[model samples]
Target: MIDAQTLEAPTENPTIRTSRRWSPGACVWCGGTESVEEYRNEPRCATCRHHESVIEEARRFMGMYGLRPIGGTLQSDDDEEYEHRLGARDSRRVLNEIRLEHQPDPELVRKALRPRAAAVVAEGKPAAKRPSTASSATGSSRTASASAKTAAPVKTGTVDIDEIQTRALALLDQLTAIDAQLSLVADQSGLAARARRSDLEKQKATVLRTLAALEKARLSAASK
Candidate 1:
């Protein structure tokens, strides 16, 4: 069954998924029209749908590698997002196809599961070879020279190591200043404790005087 649909966000109720009945035909890309492309009860042949899916996967791969598509992807037939999208759609599927003949390394096998082309790009290498750091290093020298030429010349300001050491020593001296403050606080705390005790003694004497006056008044009343 060949039916068009508007794909909703990844997990939203599709606006037009149920637009077609299940049927079979020769897949245009790879002939096997019996399989479903998007999901169960979804329209579109597997091959054609996989084609579109590859594009989305390529975008994901670019995102993973921190390669932001500037403005937008370049439009061309030979563009990576167009050609290898299907092959990179699921490297796992490719591995599974030939996995019986070869058991790959766990890491390599894991890489195989990723979007193939994207992983290659993310690793900072082409599918054909590793990154040639020699060229980059050579360019670095040129870039450095160019940058130096473009930048303002350094003012011959001399740095005095002794001055830096003096500042560091001053910082240590500031930290030690807390020791004197702490000693002062300790002395004040002791004085405050003594003052509190003196106040308590004065209160005790006043209490005793009140008790003696109360007893004298009682004796006077008895006499009356």
Candidate 2:
């Protein structure tokens, strides 16, 4: 009969390492059979790799629907299988872009689109100049040149501190409410044990408040 100890010994977890031996064949994912080789090259079987792909797709779908980039990783929504609506951040970017039509005077963009506009206002003048002529002598010439320099655009791209503070305060309120909800939910039996709603909510409020204070100070000096 097989030894009791041998039978009771645990099978290894693929994600955890406990061996130094090498397998005779290559791993399908990274072509490594040896444990060291697998460790260095991140080898895996086709099934495991496919499972990873599924998880990534799930993450992307969640992110596209405004799930706040998950906890730490910015999910790249490249999977065609899991198409979802734009998140709040993406929606804000689109809205900002739309507002540009109302105030389209960004200096860099205007300069890029109208390369010929950068030419000296007098460039079209004849090669030969009269002895007494000053470049700014004419009224029309001065007006055109001045307008080119000063009137290209006057679009504001400033970040308003007061508005930012307001947003932060709003987020703080949200966090507080979430925290209270979490505390209510944390004590529930079964699956609710793993929930960290209250902790996350409290963390959210703290981080926003700290950032708001720092930004307020920074903008105060900048505005000066």
Candidate 3:
């Protein structure tokens, strides 16, 4: 017989879980007996709901920043592994921001990052990719120069709402990553860290408003 203490027990309201059989087990963390629930791949009781919320928020925060769980910690999807390497202290704070227990002092990452510019075109799916120029070097250069001068500028009014929203979402993801880094380096000692945090805060506010407006516009258009 498996010891109930070793196995995760079911919540008081057994209906909450639909995956497996219900058993009477205690929460590994708080030893609460009321309604233990599963959290962060572990069995948590109702007493740990606050902890569960913190982790849920962290995951959402990570998703906004183009990060995914690599092992037990957060990591970027970039080819270079070092770019988004978060320390243990920083990792814990990220996992739970409310209490901020064991928060690390702010330190700038060696591989600094800047948001990239995303180009969004107006209406009709971005014109299909054109074949590369095959003419002589001099002729090809001259042709490209001529085309550049002749091409009409894309107007703001002509910009596609859906396309702009998509671009904004991508930009928001990058900004979210920057925000996360800023949080790690906030309020410690250096002027650079302070300045970076200030700039990121401003950028975060602007991006959030833009996202909200875009969402409203999308809904309005759909209704019409």
TM-score of each: 0.19, 0.26, 0.28
Residue 41 of candidate 1: its Cα lDDT? 14
Give each prediction's root-mean-square deviation over alpha carbons.
33.4, 25.8, 24.1
- Per-residue lDDT of model 1, residues 168-212, tens digit only: 455455445544444445445577756755664555454454344
Ranking by lDDT: 3, 2, 1
lDDT of 3: 0.40
lDDT string, candidate 2, 74-146, tens digits: 4443433223222323332322221111121223223332443334334664433321123212211234334
Q: Which stretches of candidate 3 lie over 4 Å from their true place?
A: 1-161
Best candidate (score: TM-score):
3
Give the Cα error of residue 160 in candidate 3, in Å.
4.0
Q: By TM-score, is 1 or 3 better?
A: 3
Counted clashes in each candidate structure:
0, 0, 2
Q: Among all windows of ten consecutive residues in candidate 2, which has the lowest summed lDDT?
A: 149-158
Model 2 root mean square deviation, Cα atoms: 25.8
On lDDT, the candidate that comes out on top is: 3
Query: Can you list the residue pairs that collide in candidate 1?
Result: none
Task: Please give the lDDT score at residue 22 for candidate 2.
Answer: 21
